[model samples]
Target: MAGAADAATTLVGRVLAGRSGALANRLDLAGIRTKPQDFAFLIGVLAVAVLAATLLLGAGWLSVIAAAASPVVAMLFLNIRIARRRDAFATQLDGTLQLLASSLRAGYSTMQALGSVAQQSEEPSASELARIVNEARIGRPVVAALEEAADRMASEDFHWTAQAIAINREVGGSLAETLDGVAHTIRERGQIRRQVKTLSSEGRLSAVILMALPFGVAGFLMIINPAYLAPLFASGLGIAMLAGGAVLMVVGGIWLYKTVEIKF
Candidate 1:
């Protein structure tokens, strides 16, 4: 039974890593896995695929195989989604914060200000804020509603900002200035992050080209000289070498990620 379960886990991992397609995404949604889970699944798949290929190709061709591309593909997808989600939330918060501050300046109560903004804006931020306001209207504390919104997004920045508003409202403070400060800080942080990303663009491009070279060359070799490249896959030793190659690739990736992940 334990062996069977392990086999099933292996199969799912392979399928997820093999291709970035509609089916893979559907599987992800069905499993309710986050971006990290999706990327991890792809890495496992790449390992299995590499082992399979090592049995079919020569040891030298291990670096060039398409089966080893899963990690890069999965990481790219995850990073793109995360970056976009952050941008969307930041953009939405800019107008929402400004409006809320202006409403407070005009003498409206905090909840009323949120409700007014909710009426004019759309999801996911607008609907999110409106839900908080409505919850507060129905006898729920504004703090609870705001906390819920922060939890839903799973963002520390949003959670902290919401807590600031909730605390200020409960204790009585200059909310307009507080909110304006929050918005300005968020915008500035986003600008700085963009600048860092822009500066790192060259490094990112180099990583891509260096990573792709081995795989590209292998594919060309496979197409041009099948018999010559068969030694890697045609023997047990060659298969072992391929597995080792996969491990090295994963370690390299982890190292590169650590190097590039500079928190601004």
Candidate 2:
């Protein structure tokens, strides 16, 4: 039994190792410090636990579904974290750019200004800027590093900042003033984004409620009377109906999300 268990663990590790690089990048974006193998193992454990719980509840089919959904749920959580981190990074960009501009006005070089911002700012901004500084110190082109950071964070504002820096390097100009102008534009964009979010809050909330309603009803039914939802899991016809409803729900959810999402 011990040898069999060891073999199984090794097999799982090997299977998970194939995607570790991509998963590592995603985990880094999400600000999670976990190793990919460990995260994969945790997800496996969670799936087994969920499967066991469903089995204990006497829903074999539901157990299978739960097992299948566990990794997807974990990915959703990872994406949410990445999004929140990206938002925080974007929110800090205006102040960070202003500070960088101030440093430049104080006679600092571009790299020096970036290093100063890395020291003075908060996380995400600080970490990202520090990375750019480090990469530049190691002889990587600062513009390239900045562009990579922008891509990693998915920040248009940061991408524009990189462009500004690149252009400033190519020609002779007042870098400080250029950064100040960029900061002003970013500040204005932030204001507009907040206004849009405020205006669309109601619609986003409605979408959330609409998406959750079916799950909420199903849970309520499960508690009130387990048998009420049993056929949906037990009978082929009922299972098909449930699958169709789930597909429709997913499509509707995506439609609602796209409808409420305002891109600038």
Candidate 3:
């Protein structure tokens, strides 16, 4: 029995690592340790949520389906958090590069410049740089360490900078000059990104309002005239329509998001 249970657990772990391993990487970028523990915690929460919905809320089959999808919802929430933190870190990167460049020009080695970045920069940037520095201190290749951080944070800018550093290390160019140019490019890109965001603010706001309109109206109707919406929840056809609407809403939301999200 113990052997069978161990085999089952191993199979589950393999499936999760194969399918949802990116979640572990996102948690790392968001500064959360204990990826395995967090995954187990999320699964436990999902189980509790499903049980409560079934027993307390008297949920039907549709609700059970939704409950089963709770892990995906939790992952989406976690991805949002990771994206926001990564954006914050990106905003800090240009300054970090500039600082590193200054340190390089002041006669510091690559490793020393990274130490300065860890000391002077703010979170995500500081922590990430510190991680690279620590890895290099432990005998890992510095370029590989930087690239690993860049990959985890999903930052092309940092990846490019790492490439430049690697090239400089091989060809023996002025490292400070290369970093300065990368810093300048990153700063300009950030400015352009901010301008684009500002220009699209109205469209983004309109999309939000449009998406919320149906839910708000439905809620108001439920409060004012419960019988008016009763069939929607009570009848099979109404339930099917609700599900269809939900799927359409999700599709439309993704489309709208893509339309407005201009990437640099």
My TM-score estimates for the predictions, one after another, are 0.64, 0.91, 0.84
The lDDT for every candidate, in the order shown, is 0.72, 0.92, 0.84
Error of 1 at 98 (Å): 1.0
Candidate order (TM-score): 2, 3, 1
Assess the local accuracy of residue 5 in candidate 1 as a C-alpha lDDT between 0 and 100. Answer: 53
Ten contiguous residues minimizing lDDT sum, candidate 1:
26-35
**Candidate 1 vs 3: which has more lDDT:** 3
Question: Best candidate per TM-score, number?
Answer: 2
| Per-residue lDDT of candidate 3, residues 137-185 (tens digit) | 9999999999999887899999999999999999998999999999888
Give candidate 1's whole-model lDDT: 0.72
Residue 89, candidate 1: Cα error in Å is 1.0
Candidate 2 vs candidate 3: which has greater lDDT? 2
Which residue segments of model 1 deviate by more than 4 Å?
1-83, 134-139
Task: Write the residue-wise lDDT of candidate 1 on 141-247 in tens digits.
Answer: 88888887776555566776787887786798899998899888878877887899999888777777766777798789999997876787889998898889878
Q: Please give the distance, in angstroms, between residue 143's alpha carbon in candidate 1 and its true position after superposition.
A: 2.0
Q: How do the candidates rank by lDDT, highest first? A: 2, 3, 1
Return the TM-score for candidate 3, rounded to 2 decimals.
0.84
lDDT of 2 by residue, 91-173 (tens): 99999998999999999999999999899999899999999999999999999999999999999999999999999999969
Tell me the RMSD of model 3 versus the true structure: 3.8
